[model samples]
Target: MVQTYTSPIRVYKTPFEFVMAAYEKRFPTCKMIPIFVGSEITSEITSEDKAVTVIERRCKLNVDAPYLLRKIAGVEFVYFIQKNTLDRRRRTLVIEAWNESFASRLVIRETCKYSVHPDNDDWTCFEQDAHLEIKSFFGFENAVEKLAIKQYMANIVKGKEVIDYYIQELIDEGVTHIPRFVPTGITEDSALDQSGIEDEITLSSLNHMALGATASSMTMDKRIHRDSLYKLDADYIHRCLGDLDPVEESRIVELKQWLQEHHKEKIPSDAHLLRFLRARGFNVEKGREMLCRSLIWRKQHQIDRLLKSWHPPDVLKTFFPGGWMDGYDDGGRPVFVLRLGNLDVKGVLRSIGVDGMLKLAITICEEGLVKCEEATRVQQRPVSYWACIFDLEGLSMRHLWRPGLKVLYRIIEVFEANYPETMGRVFLVRCPRVFPILWTLVSPFIDENTRKKFIIYGGEDHQQPEGGLTEYLDGKSIPKFLGGDAECGFPEGGIIPRSHYLPDDLAEMESGIDSISINSESLYQSVSLVKDSYHEVPVIVHDAGTVITYDFDVCKGDCIFTVLFTTSAVKIPSSTPPASPALQTSISVIHPDLKLKEVIRPIPCSDGSSEQGTHVADKAGTYILQWKGVDPTASTAVHSQFSFDFGLTSPPKCKVMYHYDILTQDEFRGSLSSVQSFSSLSMA
Candidate 1:
C-alpha cells in the first residue's frame, strides 16, 4: 500500500531568507525519502499523481517536483515559501521549520567541513597572521591604506602645483600676500593614528591639510605663519607710535593698546598708515605734527640767534639815513632837462624822495629842449642859418613830441609858437637815437613837404648837402665861394638865351646872387605865333621882333604863341625891351599854309548856363571862331585836324598838363602852374 503526504513548509520575511530556510529545513529529509522509497517510490508515484515514501511518512509529489527541488537546495525554506507558496499556513510552517533546521544544519556542516579540511583552518589562521604582519610592518591595515598614503603624497604634490599657479596669478593681478615655506614631506605622525586619527590631531591635521590644499589649489602661499606672529610689546608698540607724527602717533598708540588688550589679530603697518595719511592730503613726508614741531623749533632758534646778534641803532641807520639828499640841487626853480639816455625816470623818481620829480620828468620828456646857445648862434647868421635852426628844432621838438593825433594839433601849436621863423626856412633835423622816435611820433602830423625834407635828410644812404643842419650842429662853417676867372665871358647873339656861362662861373661866384643877362634878340628869337589871328593881337618872333600890329582887320582870326627860354642861368632877368611889331607879319609870311581869319567878340553865356560834367563837347566837327579877345578882329579857330591828328583837344586837357609837369617843366613852375604851353620853336 502507498501513503500520500505533502512536504513540510516555512515562512520568512524576505524572499531570499525564506527560500534559503525552506530548503535547509526540507532538503535533507527529502533526500532521505529517495533512499527510502527507491524502487517502491517510482511504483507508487505516477507521472501526474505520485507518492514518495520518506522517513515514516508518504509524500505526494508532482512530476516537476524534481526540477523545483533542485532549485530549492541551499535556499532558505522560508524564502522559498515566501517566493513560491500562496498558502499562509504553509508559508508559516516553512519559515518556522527553516529557522530550526538552519541552525542544526549549519552546526553539522561546520563540523563536517572542519573535519574534512583541518589544514584549510590552519591556512585561514595563517592568512590572519599574515595580515597582522603587514599591518605591523607598514603601520597600515591593508594595501589600500598604504595606497592612501601615496595618494596623500600625490595630493600634496598636486596642491603645490595649484599653489604655484595661484600665486603666479595673484602676482599678475598685483595682490600682495605673505610667503610661506613649502613642506617637503609629512614631518610627524601626530596628524594620523593607527585606527584613524585622534580628535585634536584630526582637527589640526584637517585644518593644515585643508589650508595646504586650498592654498595649493589656488596657487597661493599662506599669509600667516608662526614666524610672522609677533608678541605684543609695549616698547615696540611705543616705537611704532613714535614713527608716526605726534597727533597720529597718539591715536595709533591708543589703538595699539586696545588691540593688545583685546588680543586682536590684525594691525596696520607703518607703510599702510602713511598711505592713509597721504590719501587724506596730510603731509606724510615730514608728517603733519612733526612738521609743526620742526617749524616751531626753527622759529625759536631763529629768535634766539636774532636776540644774540641784533643791534638796533645799526639796523635803523641802514634803513633810514638822516638826510638822503645831501648834495642835490635845490631852492632854484626846477628846470627838467631830458638827458640823452633811456632811463626809467618814473621808477627813479619813485626810488628818490623828490616831491614832483615824476611830473617834471614826464613834462620834460614830452616838451623837448632847444639849447639857447645853439639857437642864438643859428639866428645870428641870416642866410639859411635860420632854416637850419628851424630844421633842428623841428627834429628835436615837433617830430619828437607829437606822439598821436589827439596831441598832434596841440604839439603843432606849441612848435609854431616856439619856432615862428621855421615857416621861412628849409628845416632839417637829424639825430640817430631820437630820430626814430621823432619819425614815428610826428610822421602823421606834418605836411608831405616836411616829410619829404625828413626823408631827404635821414633816409638810408642819403647824400647830405655841404652845409646842412648836421654840419651846423657839429660846429662846421658854410663853404665860401671863390671869384670867377677872366675867361668866363657871357655868350653873344643867339635865338634863345645861351646862359652856359652862368653854369661855368657858378662855383666861382663870391656873391650869392644867382643871376644872368641875355641880349634882346636872344630872348625874343624863339617866340612864334599860331596863324589865322587878328591885326591888333601881336605874336613874338624868332627874329628879335613881335607881331604887335597884325592884319586881322583885313585878314581872319586870333592867334596863339609860345615863348621859350633855357633856365640854366642862376638868376633870371626880370625885364626885357619890347620886340618890333614886324614879327607878326613875318610869322604870317613864314607860315603861308595857315589861313588867315578875322577875330570877333566871344559871346559870353549867362551866369549859370554852363554846368560841370564828365563830357565836354557834343559835336565831332570843327567849331567856328570864338574867343574872349580884347580886339574885335581876334578870333580863335579850331581845326578838326588839330583834334584828331594831334589828340591834344581832348576832354582831359588837365591830365596832359600834369603829366608834362614832372617831365619837362621847372620844379617851382610845375608845382605852381595850371596852364601848359607847347612850343614848336622850342623843339628846334
Candidate 2:
C-alpha cells in the first residue's frame, strides 16, 4: 500500500529570485535544523550561456527513531539524493528528492517546486508533495508509516520560518536584490555588461538547468470569478482549508465545464466545487451529475431560503439534545455536539412529523455555513469546515427504534447530499457494542471518504494514555462532562417528556406537509378481488373556479389515480362517522346513483416519483378522488414472490403514497410564488 500527502502552498512575500537565494542557504549545514546533518554537492551542470543550471547533491539526515530500531536496521545514518533544476527564462525551480538508504525495503519520494506567483510575480509560491510506500518492513509497516507521517508533519510547519531567517540574513548583508535573468548570448567581453553585473548571472547557460520549461499546467477560467460568492484563485482552496492537491485544480476545471453545460445558473466557487469533487474522489463526471441533481432539488424545495425561514419546534429546540456550541474546538472551526442517547427520536417524530424534522436539520446546516465564514475571519485563513462530537453515553437499541429508522435514513440522505465536506473531525466516545450493528446498516449509504473520518472509542479507550478525544481537541476546551474542565451548560439528555407532544393535526400544519408513510401496514395490502376495485374520498366545492391541487408520491408500487366529480350533490347523515383521511379511499364506488362528471388521470408514477398538479373547477358539486387497481390477468391476488416476467399479474399489494389540499380563489392569487407557504390538507 502507498500513502501520499500534499501540503498547502507556502507563500513568501519576496520575489522568486530572492526566495531562491533564501532556500539555497538551507544546504551544507544548519544549526537551526538538527536532523539535517549536512549536504555536499555531488554534481553541477549549467547551460552554455548560464540560462539553466542542474545540481545534484547527497544529503545526510539523522532519523528520529529509537536507538533500538537504529541498531536493528544496522544503520547509523540515512542518506537522500537531491536534484534541483533552475530555469532562468521560465522563472521556475523544480526539486526532486528521494531516500537512498532503504531503497529496497522502503520507497520514499518527495517533490517541491518554487515558482513565480502567477498573480503577483513579486511573490513566490512553494508547493510540496510526498509519496511513501512500504513493501516490506519486518511486520512493522504500520508503525513505520505512522512515525514517518508524524515527523513529516512536524518538519513542514517550520519550513517557512527557516526561509524567513535566511531572507533577513541576506537583507542584513545588503544583497537584497538579484537581477532577473535575461537571455544574452555569450558576452564578447566576458565582463561587466550594460547592467554593470557579471555574465554568470545571465540566462545564456541556463539550458543546462533542465527545469522542465513547459510551464505549470495550472489554469483558471475567467468565468469562474463572476459567479462566485468569494474570489477564487488557483490556490483558493488551499488557502481556505490549508490542504489541497494539484489534481483537484484539474478536477475543478472539468466540473466547471460540466456545470456550464448542464446548469448555467449555479455559480462556481473553488470552495464549492472542491467539496463535490472531494466527495466523489475527484471523479469529475460523477461529481457534476450529483451536484446538478442537488441544485435542481434545492430550487424545487427553496432550500436557499432555509436559513432565513426555518424554525424548529419548541420541543425540538429545547429537548433534542443537539446544538452547536457558542465557541469553537480550539481550531477556528465551529463545534457541534449531539447527545445521541438523550434524543427522543421516536417522540420527536411523533410530535413534529418528518417534514418538520427535515426543516430543523436544514436550520442546523445553514447555520453551519455561517459559522464557517465567521471562523475564516477569526482564523485569518479559510476555515470552511467544522467539527462534531458524538456522545453515546446513554445510547441503546431503543434509540434506533424501527418506527423512526426510516425517518433517520431520510435525514441522513438529505444531509449527505446537500452538505458535502462540512465535517472536519467526528469524535464518538463510549459507543456501545450494539452500535456497529446499526452502523453496518447505515454505513453503505454514507460516502466512503466521509466514513473514513469517523473515529470511535469504547471502554477505557475514552481517556488516559489513549487521549481519545484529546487527540483532536484541546484538553483546555474539552467540555466538563467529557472529563475536561470546560462547562458545556447543556442538558443531561434523556427521554423527552411525552406530555409535551403536539397534536398530530397541529404538527402537520406547522410543517406545511401532511406526509403518510407507505410502509407495509395500510397503503400496502393484499388485494384478492376478481374485478376492478375503487377507493374514493369525497370532496365538496363551495364555489366555482377554485384551484384544486393534488400531490402524491409512489413509495412502493404503482396504482392508477383519477379525480371523479359527482354530478349530483348528496349530503351525509349526521350520525355517520367522518372518514379516516389517511386511508379515506374506502368509500363504496359510485355506480347508478351519480354520474362520473370528470376523469383527471395523470401519467403513471414510477418508484420514488412525485406527481403534483392543479385544476380549475368550473362547476360546484361533490367530487371523489379515486385510487384503483384492476389488472385483467387473474381472479386471485397476484403472487408476492419475486419474478422478472412482465406478462404476469401485478404484485398482490400495490403501495400508493398520496396527500392533497384545496385552495380557494383568493388563496390561489399568489400560489405561484407562495406554494410552500400554503397549509396542507386538514386531517378534519
TM-score, each model? 0.14, 0.46
Tens-digit lDDT track for model 1 on 1-684? Answer: 111111111111223212223333343234322321211111211222111111221222212123433354333121111111212111111111111222322211000000111222111000000010121212223442343234333422342244345444544777454221112343323212321343345545556676664444343223233212322222333332223322333333333333334434344343223333433344333343442332343344342243334332321223211111111111111111111222222122222212122222223222221222233234331111122211121222222211112233433533432222222223232233334433444566654444443322332111244544333222122111111111211121111112211232331131122111111121111122233221122222222211111111111222322211221211112252213334223323544443443322333322111111111112222112211212222233444324354535422100000000011122112111111221110110
**Candidate 2 Cα outliers beyond 4 Å, as residue runs:** 185-239, 242-360, 374-409, 416-684
Which runs of model 1 end up more than 4 angstroms from their true locations? 1-409, 417-419, 422-441, 447-684
**CA lDDT of each prediction against the hidden true structure:** 0.25, 0.67
- lDDT of candidate 2 over 1-684, digit per residue (tens): 676765556678898889888888898987778999999999999998686899999999997987877888889889999999997756689999999988999999999888877678689887777889999876778878977877677667667778989999999999979877755754533422533353333432342343322221111233334333232344556666456444454456556655655565756455667777778887777888778777877788877888877776677757787777766765667888887867877677767766767777777788888888888867778876788888776765566544355566767788798789988777776665556545655777877777877777664465754556666666655676777666665666656665776664564454335332213122222222112444455678878977786655444445567787865775444354433232323344324556676558535544334455666788888777666644423333553354356758544434444555577967654344333322221001
What is the TM-score (0 to 1) of candidate 2? 0.46
Highest lDDT against the true fold, candidate: 2
**For candidate 2, what is the lDDT?**
0.67
Name the weakest run of 10 consecutive residues (lDDT summed) in model 2.
675-684
Clashes of each: 54, 17
